[model samples]
Target: MLIEQILKTKGGDVTIIKADHTLAEAARILDEARIGAVVAMNGDQLAGVLSERDILRQVARHGAYALQMTVENSMTRGVITATPQETIDQCLGRMTDRRIRHLPVLRDGRLAGIISIGDLVKWKIEEHKAEADAMAEYIKGG
Candidate 1:
């Protein structure tokens, strides 16, 4: 399936946090949203992405002081992004190759949405179940 199709089902609302926001603030947003990451924005521009992993790394490296660090300092920059037109397989390949779990979707250099590995995996599972059911029905009819 295409990313656009996934977005249609998942909605395109992206949770955003300012680059200057503290890690503690980012963590709060993530917990409240029940999301693993948030898009870090800089005055309407996409600056980076701050993920749970990123925050954990900071805490590991800096102890409790990491919570005071700005999101920009803990975020993953030069982010790997996806377009709405891309296919699930293509995105899976990219994510697997990069060893990343989330992808920010962009349209005309603007953030449109974001997808997690969980989303892709869920779609895949649903697709397989549908196919299996179809095959079983076909065999019964035959």
Candidate 2:
């Protein structure tokens, strides 16, 4: 299925954090939202992505003082993005190759949605289960 279809099922609400926001603020948002990441926006432009991984890395490297740093300081800048037309397999491949979990979906220079590896895995598992059920039904009918 295409990313657009996944967005339709998952809802297209995009959570964002200002580039100037502190890591502490971003962490609060993530914790409150129960989400792994948030899009870092510089005005209307997509500046980067700030994820839990980034926060963990900062803490590990710089101790608790890292929390005072701005999101732009720890965020993954020049983030890789996907288009709505891209298939799940394509997105999976990109995520695997980049060793990243989240992907921001862009269409016509606008932020469209976001997808995570968990979402793709869920879709794949559901598809596999349906196929197996269909095969079992075919065997019983024959």
Candidate 3:
């Protein structure tokens, strides 16, 4: 299935934060939203992406002081993005190659939605189960 299909099932709401926001604030947003990452936006422009991994990396290097730092400092600038038309396999490949857990979907030069590795894996498992069930039915029918 394509990314658009996934978005349709997963909902198109995207969690975003400003570049100037502090890591502490970002952490709170992530925790409260129960999301893995937040898109950093500078007005209508996409600036970067701040993920839980990025926050952890900063904490490892800078301790508690990292929380006081700006999200822009820890965010992955020039983030890799995906289009709605892209296939799940293609997106999975990109995520694996980049060692990233999240990918923001862009359409018409605007942020559309975000997809996580969890979402891809869930879809794959469901597809597999459906195929297995179909095979069983076919065997019984024959």
Candidate 4:
């Protein structure tokens, strides 16, 4: 399956935050959105990504005061991106190698959507089940 198909099912809504937004604000957005990460934007440009792991790391190093720092301070820079044309299995390999859970999907050099490891795993499992069911039906018919 292609990344585009996953996005079609997951929808194209990306929860974005400004680079200047405080960790406190970022936390609120994460909690309210019930998402693990958000794309950090700088005047319509992709800055980086802020994840629960990023927030926890900052808090571990700087204490509660880290909450006052900007998202740019804690966000992971040089983010690895995925194109709509990428295959699900191929993405799984890259994500595993990089130890990243989130990937920003780009189309035409612009942010299109964001996908998480959970999403890929879920879809992969579904694909496997569908394939197995098809094979079983073929056997029964034969």
Per-candidate TM-scores read 0.97, 0.96, 0.97, 0.98
C-alpha positional error of residue 3 in candidate 4 after TM-score superposition, expressed in Å: 0.3
Error of 4 at 102 (Å): 0.4
Candidate 4 wrong stretches, greater than 4 Å: none
lDDT of 4 by residue, 20-91 (tens): 999999999999999999999987788999999999999999999999999999999999999999999989
Which candidate ranks first by TM-score, i.e. highest? 4
- Give model 3's TM-score versus the native structure: 0.97
The residue pairs found clashing in candidate 1 are: none
- 1-142, model 2: which lDDT tens digit per residue? 8999999999888899999999999999999999999999988799999999999999999999999999999999989999999999999999999999999999898899999999999998888899999999999999
Candidate 1 scores a C-alpha RMSD against the true structure in Å of 0.8
lDDT of each: 0.96, 0.95, 0.95, 0.95
**Model 2: colliding residue pairs:** none
For candidate 2, report its TM-score.
Answer: 0.96
Q: Where's the lowest-lDDT run of ten residues in candidate 4?
A: 41-50
Measured with C-alpha atoms, the lDDT of residue 31 in candidate 2 is 98
